[model samples]
Target: KLKDAHCAILVVKMKRTLIMFSFILLQLLLGNSLSPKHSSPKPNAEVTVMGFVYCDVCSNNSFTRHSYFMSGVEVRIVCRFKAASSRTNEMITFSANRTTNEFGLYKVAITSLDCADVDSLASSCQAKILSTTRNEKLVDRL
Candidate 1:
C-alpha cells in the first residue's frame, strides 16, 4: 500500500511539472506574437550575405583595378520585396548594417524573421558603399 501511494505521488508531481512547463511555453508564444518585431517565421532555414570593401587607391574606373582592400568600412545589406496593391506597389524591406572584418569582408545573416517579405534572390537584395571610415587625402599634379 505504501509503495502504491509513493508511485501515485510521483505521477502527480510529474503531471504538475508538465502542466507548468506547458503554461510557460504558451505564455512565451503569446508574448512573442504580440511584438511586431517578433513575427511568425518558420525555423531551420537561414540566409547569409557576404561581401568585401575595397578602396581605389589610384584613380581607376574598373572594379578590379582597385589597389587597396580597405577594412573598417561600414556596409549595409538591404533586402526588399514588392507586391502590387490597388494602384501602387507596396514595398517590404529588411536591412542589416555591420562593419567589415579584418579581411575587409562583411557578412549579414538574414533569417526569415529578418526578411519579412524578401527572398534570397539576387534581384531582391542589394549592397551599396555608404562611407569610408576616414577621409583620404588627394594629390594634385603640379
Candidate 2:
C-alpha cells in the first residue's frame, strides 16, 4: 500500500509540472501573436531634416575659431524621393521652410508615406538659405 501511495504521489507531481509547462507555453505564444507589428515606419511617420547655420568669419569656406552660429536664419529644405518600385515614374518632392532657433539650429519635419528611409534623403536632399535676420548674406556650404 505504501508503494502504491508513493507511485500515485509521483504521478500527481508529474501532472502538475506538465500543466504548469503547458500554461507557460500558451502564454508565450499568445504574447507573441498579440504584440503589435512594426517592421517599418508607419504611414504618418515624421522625418526631420535638421542643420545648423554658422558664419565663416574667416571666409575660407570652413568653420574656424572665429566662426559663430547665426540665429533667426531662414532655411529652405527640399527632398526628392523616387518611387520604391521602378514601375511608376513618380518623383515625390517635399519642401519646407524653417527658421534657426537660438542655437542656430533649423529643423523641418516632413510627414510623408513616400519617404522610406533617411538614406534616400541624403542622396537627393538639398538645403539652401532663404534669408537671415543679420545683414550678412548666407551661402550653401554643403
What lDDT score belongs to each candidate, Candidate 1 first?
0.65, 0.77
Worst 10 residues of 2 by lDDT: 112-121
| Error of model 2, residue 116, in angstroms | 5.0
Candidate 2 lDDT over residue span 1-142, tens digit each: 9999999999999999999999999999999999997698555756777888888767777777888888888888888877565577677788888888897888877775454544566667788998876765344443
Model 2 global lDDT (CA atoms, 0 to 1): 0.77
lDDT of 1 by residue, 15-117 (tens): 9999999999999999888867955655644567777766556656334544556677777788776532345466767788877778678888766543333
lDDT of 1: 0.65
Stretches > 4 Å off in candidate 1: 1-44, 63-66, 82-90, 113-120, 136-142
How many angstroms is residue 120 displaced in model 1 relative to the true structure, after the best TM-score fit?
6.2
Off by over 4 Å in 2: 1-45, 114-118, 137-142
Compared with the true structure, model 2 gives a TM-score of 0.62
RMSD of each: 11.3, 4.7
TM-score of each: 0.49, 0.62
